[model samples]
Target chain A: MPVFDQGYRRFEGTLRPRHALGALVWTAVRPRLRWWLWLLAAILSFYPGLVYAAITFITLAVGPDAFGGRNRLPEASGAFVAFSDNGDPSQLVAELLAPTTAGIVARLWRISEQCALAGFVLPAVACAGVIATDRATGAHQIYFARPVTRMRYLLSRIAAVTVFCSVATVLPPLLVWLETAALHDDPWFAAQTWSAPFAIALSGAVYAYFVSGVVLALSSTLRRPLVVGLATIFSYLFLQVVSAMIVHGLEDKRWRALDPQYALGGITAPLYGVALPDWLQTPWPWLVGLVVPTLLLAYVWSRLRAVEVAT
Target chain B: MTSTAPVVRVTALEKRFGAVRALRGLDAAFPRGAVGLLGPNGAGKSTLLKVLLGLLEPDRGDAEVLGLRVAADPMAVRRAVGYMPEVDAYVSGLTGAASVRLAGILCGLPGRAAQQRAHEILYYVGLGEARYRRVEEYSTGMRQRLRFAQALVHDPELIFLDEPTNGLDPDGRDEMLALVDDLARHHGKSIVLCSHLLHDVEAVCEHVVVLREGTVALSGSVDDVRKLERGTFHVRVSGDEARFRAAAEAAGMHFAAQDGETLVVRVPDGAGAREIFRAAHAAGCVVRRLATVEQSLEGVFLRAVEGAAEARA
Candidate 1:
């Protein structure tokens, strides 16, 4: 055997593989924490309070009779009146708050989901930036020159970025929950009222994961993180707008399933007392919809895995 | 020195980038010493380093590092050899210590040990004070040192430093050179010093491989490769010019020129000094001084590169 071979074997025998997953996650998450913390603070300070304030203001201004009562408008008018027939003011209050609160929560959830979608752009750009910076600063050579292979290095980066996206997606819902608990007194608030928030949070997490995968894929192909980020955002917005236009223009009931907003509407129809079609009711569409984006992201990751550090 | 096989050996290694032939049938060996890879830009120095590291696939031929074939077992080779690349590259947002630790871990060191080794190696490379600082904040010299630290952290037997002193100041350059010397001499590490600076190479390297246009133009020990050309001498004499010239001519010595009280002469190789002394004494010339001129590495490198260029032309 060659001298280096003997030396390497001896060294390998002595050395242990360092599994610093926590350290890696910490390193990846720490930088983005400041931004997320500020976001969490903002969400906590404004969102739940905004919901409570909007509910309180609407209750005072419009009263409980506007929804369903003797005072209900046969001809819709800009008038506020209290009804004598409903009997239960609390139920009326809940009814008054439900749509507005759900609307606010759903909107907030959509915003979070959109942000999660926006986040998909980030990991790709972030990973690409990390790789590109490594190349620019000669770190890629330094890192690759060590015992680490390109695949391991790339995987570590993806892992780190995935952790970062997860934290970003999860933190907002957590802040909203804590804030709601601190502010609200409704017995149904925790059990019944939180379903929308939970769904929004769950969907956001899934979306974030999907986005991270897609971004990692983009990062592998493109060297410039900014280009990847901008391209991703543009592509997503373009797809959303075009898909919406096609769905709305065709008015084909089958194509409605393809529209994400419509799909979401279909999912939430029970809350609005609308009957969903049998095809939309089945689990297959949601499963297929979720799986398609995931598969595309996996395809992206496979492509990224093939990208060699050009430096 | 230990009767072990060569650490690295390359036979007719060739690489091409599409139409651009980067390495053309280059044969070389990196033995157990501080070996210098001297070449100008585009001379395949970087390509050769990458090939040795098993980072790039060779278009033809084969290379073995630490007994691991470059094509067949690159990971094995990488685990055995540490490389400092020619260009500036690093992991962003990581502290200098973190970067080194990451490299150490990838080299298979456990967490605590990797951290400890990272600190020690960084200190060795003069990055002790800056260990906690992010790599983005490091100066060019610090970055270079960190690069060296990463290479050494794995405790690899052979280290490849590509233009290790590129952006350093004079003091930094000297320190880097001293560190490289210490690594080779004291730590028993074999090094491949890839640099365009002939002076830096001469300062630390005992053997050198000079590449010209992707081929080995010359390769040998530093001393042997810089052998002085015959017929050059440094002479000092106090005598009449005419008698001195006549005496030198009569003795079959070629007189080149006179400078002040000295005469430059072309003495035959292996000629005894006593012959010149006697000839000068007979001619009533006082021989003040006599010495032989040695060739500089710069001269040898220039000649080798020029010769290769001429050969190709």
Candidate 2:
């Protein structure tokens, strides 16, 4: 290691290192984390979890054979009915719910698919105008002039918006999985559905990451917050519309992966052990799904570096 | 940190912007105190400042701020110094105090210390009552004060003020200048004041560096640079102006009338009153009034700029 010279000490008191990244993240997200908005996000996010939980409870209470064709019980009687076979009912129930892990994971994936709009809404609402508004007010000059590095600034802002989106997209589903798993007294239920939480978390992480990155990249390109926000929504819609038109016009469903939501679903479906449809079996969905968001984030980093250095 | 040392040093610094060269082998040193940075548009004042602040990298050369090499450790240099931008810069949706506190925190102060410094600096800058007001709602003067407060909240040893009084009214400008003077004199902070207003610089700064065409045209003490080589005397004579001009020319001096009543004469560098007296006596004119001319910073600035222009041509 090269020895460095310790120059004149400027201050008499103890000096503390600036927690610049933490400060930046807090400052960026604090104003947007209103109670009502968080409550709305929680309600929207937990809706699918609640629905999943209700289904699990109903299945547990009524018996898995209630909906199955194997049962010969009469529909008129409201009393509890069980098989007269010489076997334990609880063990039989555990055996029934054990194989339902695939269904549970598939339901979680479907939850993500159903709330695709929430992914866009949460990140867009959190970071829609963040970079644009800062540029408009020349706040970047002051920020870059401080001791905070450009990378720290960029990462902090991305992480701040990611917090909003991850809370809505990632957390609720995991909690719901935990709660659902706890409802069953089956030990194998824990072992069978152990991967369900990971699947939920992975799918949620991917969605949150892609949406936050793309939204911030869009924010970096424009100067007006309103325009940036509108452009984000419209661009996603436009891609979706164009992709649909092309898929219909060409009569090739593989073109559906050109849409971000469909591309994201392609990635999430397999995480839940669901097979893709014939058209999405191609690598186009995975390619576009991973590359597009990475490219958007790279663009955001470059734009921020340019703005900081070139200013 | 030492009063006798230069707070900023640039050696043969060069910066280019595609086809345009913003800084060309520029060399300058700003001593610890109040120094004014004077330049015309495109004279590399902003470029030099950015380089020193570590916002822009120099294409070729070395720069040091507070004895730390900027290229090697820019963040440290930035932490040691403060910059007040010329533009209206503030984080939107934040109050004045919040803005200052954020700046302090970003500059390496602890959160509580930053809060305390923000409050104290806002009050010191006369924004005490309006500290809670949103920065967007502030008037131009209040915004300018807010900018100053943020720059000073961290209490850096050096501060770069870019057009601090840009949009201030007369009273606000005076107050700002007074604060700058106080910082330099009482607080022992080094300041590099960049402005188009020469009087403002002359009023508060002890030294100045004039830039022309991406290079230092002149740099020295303000009083030393304002000193004219030849003594310029304003002489009011009661007799024939033609004869006084002829006699002044005979004495190897130049004379011009500032107005109908006052004739100005410039004597040789060493010779002074004797030549003016001899010229007046020889011309048979009554030397009613004679006073030496005081050079203005504007005159020095113009000469440096024009001199550099001529040299370039």
**lDDT (Cα, tens digit) per residue for candidate 1, span A1-311:** 11121121123347554444454445444544456545653453344334434544444346645346534422211111111123333433443445445543543343343344434444544444544444445555555555555556655666666654544444554555455544545545556555655664555555554555555555555677687667666655665577667656986445545544344444444542335555467663354346655676666545533433243
Docking level of model 1: incorrect
Worst-scoring 10-residue span by lDDT in model 2 chain A: A1-10
Best by lDDT: 2
What lDDT tens digits, residue by residue, belong to model 2 across residues B140-213?
88988888887887788899999999999888888899888888987789999999899999999999999988
Poorly placed runs, candidate 1 (over 4 Å) = A1-13, A17-27, A35-128, A168-206, A217-231, A252-309, B1-3, B228-293
- The DockQ scores of all candidates, in the order shown, are 0.23, 0.29
CA RMSD, predictions in order: 9.9, 8.3
DockQ metric, candidate 2: 0.29
Backbone clash numbers for all candidates listed = 9, 0
Candidate 2's residue-wise lDDT over A96-123, tens digit each?
Answer: 3553666566656666665666677766
For TM-score, the strongest prediction is 2
Best by DockQ: 2
